[model samples]
Target: MKKVLFCLLALGFLGGCSTKEEPKDVTYDWAPPFEEVRWSMGEDAVFETLDLDEEDATLNVNPEKQRVFSFASAMETEVGMVAPDFIFEPGFGLVGVNLHYIPMEKEAAETLAKLEAAYGKSDDGTWSGTKFGELNLSDEQVAAFKKEADIDKDEPVVTIALNQDAQAVKYQECVFEGKNAAILEQVLAK
Candidate 1:
């Protein structure tokens, strides 16, 4: 009786000690809907000035080479009449999408003064000091911009051209993270 009881207790303890099965890994291979999505960068009031090469300016981005995407729209909207979008290719775990808007002629001085106070200085030499027009974004600012743009920090970036009206031309870029190919597919679908 003692032996039988001991055996039963051992079996019960062993059974209780058995390990649970691990969960199966999930694979995501289906491509995202990249074509159907079109994100608006808001109105021209928020953009800046950029110089770009007309011949090579397009959305298709090459990771190995340096490319310039410019947004200079609303040339006639206000005083200084300048709105530029500048995007540089991916580098240093960072991607840039800069917006520059110069108020029309009548407002250029005042607008520039305001911008200088807020951003820094305009690199265009329009200002005696450092050019605030040139963006020197901090890490926090970059992160915020990425969040606003819905881009992942780990992804490679692809450029997109928006707004081709004679008055304004805007540029955008898609930055991809690990396995972001799927996200790109989704963005292209819209």
Candidate 2:
């Protein structure tokens, strides 16, 4: 009787340990906003400028004639404000654009994969992902992440992080369409 009782107790404890609950799926409906402009050169030609604030740069393309122009600058004051870079390809009608700002290379790659899974393919080849949440972080996690990442307090970190990340990702997606589509890939990734 003692042996049977001990075995049952052990089995109960093991079963309880194995029954960890899965994480809940989180959803967000907010999106980031970007600016677009139109430019004209010397002649009768008119060009459109996709001013992506995420990367602090602009892409000028003449879709009718199939011409491309790029301009880039470094970010100075604000966190998301960085100069942009442009690459020109004559034949391809704005194939893609991508901007990444994650400190770790591995994190950046993981972010990209999450984005690809969510949106199919980034329109402009740009994407961003940040991790911030209500869950209390260990001292080590906070210290390690803070050394290179911009972790804000007061506001929900996950929301802010996702917004920043969305800007870059949407910029790439909007490269061809000239319209920004903000999607939170991080929540899904987690």
Candidate 3:
């Protein structure tokens, strides 16, 4: 009877002194913001954001065309050293940028496949499928990529396209917000 009582008391004590803990607070809406050289940002702001070899970077101004261009072997990407051109206009400020020139030696399709595995393929090309930063993201089962890189709704989101003929990925960026793209189109047209 004493042994039975001791066992019962021990069981009761063990039950009372439970090791189970309260559930941890889970974060749901955690997404990173991708803000850089934004729309309408001036030349100084553009330079401030870029990590360039300032000694090599050259600024060319055409008074007749009212066009300004800054370019250099500014970035040594995973592929190779690339000269990214930053295009600006007087009133339009920092208008556009031609960046991320992947060397032809690196197969663009192979490069794209790796990105697609992590981010998923978009209608246009391989995209970071966070629903354009709109939906619930998986935070990636394989990797930590839950959503697309974050940017303001009004900011320009750069996209890459596979240039099969060239065997390269093209970095096309228009540094304009909303209907400003159309405005740029009109300017280019002129």
Q: Say which candidate scores most in lDDT.
A: 3
Rank order (by lDDT, best first): 3, 2, 1
Model 2 scores a TM of 0.22
Please report how far candidate 1 places residue 121 from its true position, in Å.
7.7
Over the stretch 40-125, how does candidate 2's per-residue lDDT look in tens digits? 11111212333233333344555654333333443321223332333233322222222324444464455455545643455544
Computed on alpha carbons, the lDDT of every model, listed in order, comes to 0.34, 0.35, 0.42
Q: Tell how far residue 34 is off in model 3, in angstroms.
A: 8.1
- TM-scores vs. true structure, each candidate: 0.24, 0.22, 0.40
Tell me the lDDT of model 3 at 17: 96
Question: RMSD, each candidate, Å?
Answer: 15.6, 18.5, 14.9
Of candidates 3 and 1, the better by TM-score: 3
In model 1, state the lDDT of residue 177: 25
Model 3 / residue 165 / CA error / Å: 2.7
In the range 22-137, model 1's lDDT, one tens digit per residue, is 33222321111122211222112122222234443344454645333554444322222343332333422113333344324444356545444533465542222121122243
- Candidate no. 1 TM-score: 0.24
